[model samples]
Target: MHLLKIHGSGDARLDDYQRPEAGPNDVIVKMKNCGICGSDLTYIKIGGIPTPGTITALGHEGSGEIMEVGSAVDGINVGDRVIVNPMQTPSNIGSGGPEGAFTEELLVREARLGMSILPIPAGIPYEIAAMCEPLAVAMHGVNRAELKAGDKAVVFGCGPIGLGMVLWLVDRGIDVVALDLAAERRERALALGAQAALDPTQIDLRAELAKLHGEVPSYGRVGVGTDAFIDAAGAPNILSEVVAIAKYHSRMVITAAHMKPIEFPAGRMLTSEMTITTAMGYPTEMPDVIAAMPRLQDKIASMISHRLPLSQVLDGLKIAATPESCKVMINIDEE
Candidate 1:
């Protein structure tokens, strides 16, 4: 079978791999559309992800059809459209596993399967179904924030995750502001329903928030500081900005992992009484993320700025890093 493998550090190409066995406990999918996650770019350029592993199949966010289902995998049948959740660790004693997410024909654990399956309601499309994973990721951040209706939310970063966060927050009737350095992203965020979008590099976030809410007549609402601040930006200092804009008792959720050690101000956190939580991608939130798809609309699929055949995988990765592109989708099933 043809699969996408990293040709070398900073590259990717089609490689013939042994076919996956259709075992009773296993499920096999014919690749369809897969998004090039930022993590995939890191692995290709940096040789691999933070963890060590020889380049194997690469691609995590994808939607496809069930060509065959193992006998043990009941309720699943051929022609059943599905999306594979690429992240998981097989349950076992002292099991420790973490690695890459890029692949064509994905084999996922039955228990770790996500909301990628069909039965997509009246308006949902297969491309959108492929997006449940990232939406679920943003949902994890929102879930951690403990957001409520009418609350204000600021999502930092206009990357796919950040945009998804904004869409989710807005769908819940919460007023939101999306912050990013890219003007295009800021525009996209607003289009996704953020009441306002600002380029933090050009606008003072503190001042902008105060302007929108007017004077906080009373300080004890506990809802101050945006009810919740989501740092979708991977930059470390951006996390501090999330903390800075948070009201007393408001929570700050870090959705992206930092590549460096960021200096955090101990004094402000202690004085403001703000709570902080970091969201790690896991199997826990996939269902709710998938269930919320109807509200996300086409904003999820619209994020796909470019689509290329799998033979051009490396070129696709490069496009994802550019400011002009949003989400780059790789047509892995294509020659």
Candidate 2:
């Protein structure tokens, strides 16, 4: 088998790997599709994951067919299509594990149903099924926001995860205003059912939010009535800017991985009584995300802006690093 791995700074290459064997309690999946995430670029730029490891495999958002099932495993069989939950795996497969989905096959040790893997509905395409991982991350962010129907949200970023936030929010009947500097991303957000998509640089975001979500009056001051805000943009000033203008009692969820220390205006935030939280890997959101995939297939499909075969994953990573693309998928089964 062949897989992509990072050796050192700015060094990611395809190398031969031994084919995995399924133990009595393990399974081997034939990888079909995997999406290149922004973090993959970061890893390549700075060598492997920060953890103490000489080499690290790359790829997490993926889906595949059960090529080999464990003799002891139940409810999962060969030929069953499934999406992996990397976090549930013993070694966090892909990020810095012994196995990565960017390979011909992946070994799932101690595989179990609805935990290490979940069934992909028959109709969902493998490329879209590959998105389940990131969508689950987005769903975790949405769950953190504690949003309700008829509420309003402003998603700060129209990248894959941010766009996923838009889709999930819209499906829950929330009015969403997605912000991105890229016109293409903004347009994509609108296509995913956000009530409005605006470039924050091109508009008065607070004023626009006020008009779209109505205005909230609190302690002789007015703020946008949006009930929640999601920071998927990772901009240095996004947190401060949101804290400066967030409505009273509203919520903010930070899903973006900011590399640098950001300024958090505690004084400004205190006045609003707003709650701020952070979401990382999905805890219990993958099941719901998978269940929603069938109904949201069309919307999810629009998020994919580019596709490349596994052999061209390096180029795919370059494309994903640019603003022109969203959800660059590696068709592992191709070429």
Candidate 3:
């Protein structure tokens, strides 16, 4: 097997590696498409996630085809197209750890059967199927927000996850305002389905939010408030800003992976009765994401701005880190 293993900070190499033999109930899969998530970039730039020296192999947003099924593997077939739920891996290390799906071939044990491995419809492209993980994540965020139809949501970031939220919010008939610092991202957000994409720095966020309604309330509540506020940028001061802009009783969800403790303004939240919550990895989203695949394909595909073979993964990482890039897919089986 050939895998990209992280040795230390700023050190990852595609090297020949050994994979364990499949057990009676194990399945082996050949990697087809894998996405380089924001977390993957964070892991690379900051040594490792959680702590340095913890992660060995790094990549989890991946899709593949079963090449061989164990003798005891009954329900699964060798040719089935599948997505590996990295969360259910036996070691339970999460993505970007030693047991992730970054290799040419992966050995999946039965322990992960119904929980982690999901079979997608055959016609779905590997590139789109590779996005199942992130889409699921966005769905989880939406679920946490619990916004109703016709309510408005302000997504404070236009990265893959933020844009994904826009897709779902619009699909569900929730008006969406996508905010980002990048012009390209803002445009992409609008194209994907945001009612509007605004440069947060260019516009008065408070004023703009207030305008969403008729006008800023003259007393008590002063700004244009939103029903749901999502912070996906993980930028410094994002939490505080969202707290400030949040409307009374608005639901705010933090989907960004903040590396540090956030200092939220307790008074701001208390005054308006704003409910702030955090969402981690997706819990129940696969079915919905898969069901909406046809409608989401174009926008999801547009986010894949760059593709690279496993040999040039280092270069791919560089491209992925740039502001101009969106989702960067790595084709593992490219020869």
Best by TM-score: 2
Backbone N/Cα/C clashes per model? 10, 0, 2
Model 2, span 54-153: residue lDDT tens? 5999889989999898899999999999999899999788887778889989998899998998999989999989999899889999999998899999
Angstrom error at residue 122, model 1: 6.1
Q: What are the per-residue Cα lDDT tens digits for candidate 1 across 74-161? A: 6777787666665542521011122123345655545223333433445676567767777778888888889899888788888888
- Poorest stretch of ten by lDDT in candidate 1: 91-100
Deviating ranges (above 4 Å) for candidate 2: none
Model 2 weakest 10-residue run by lDDT: 45-54
lDDT of 2 at 64: 93
Candidates in order, TM-scores: namely 0.87, 0.97, 0.94
Put the candidates in TM-score order, highest first. Answer: 2, 3, 1
**Clash-forming residue pairs, model 3:** 209-224, 210-224
Q: Which ranges in model 3 have alpha carbons more than 4 Å from their true place?
A: 93-97, 111-113, 213-219
Could you tell me the lDDT of residue 247 within candidate 2?
Answer: 82
Candidate 2's displacement at residue 80, Å, is 1.3
lDDT of 1 at 322: 83
Error of 1 at 90 (Å): 3.4
Query: Which of the two candidates, 1 or 3, achieves a greater lDDT against the reference?
Result: 3
Error of 2 at 332 (Å): 0.8
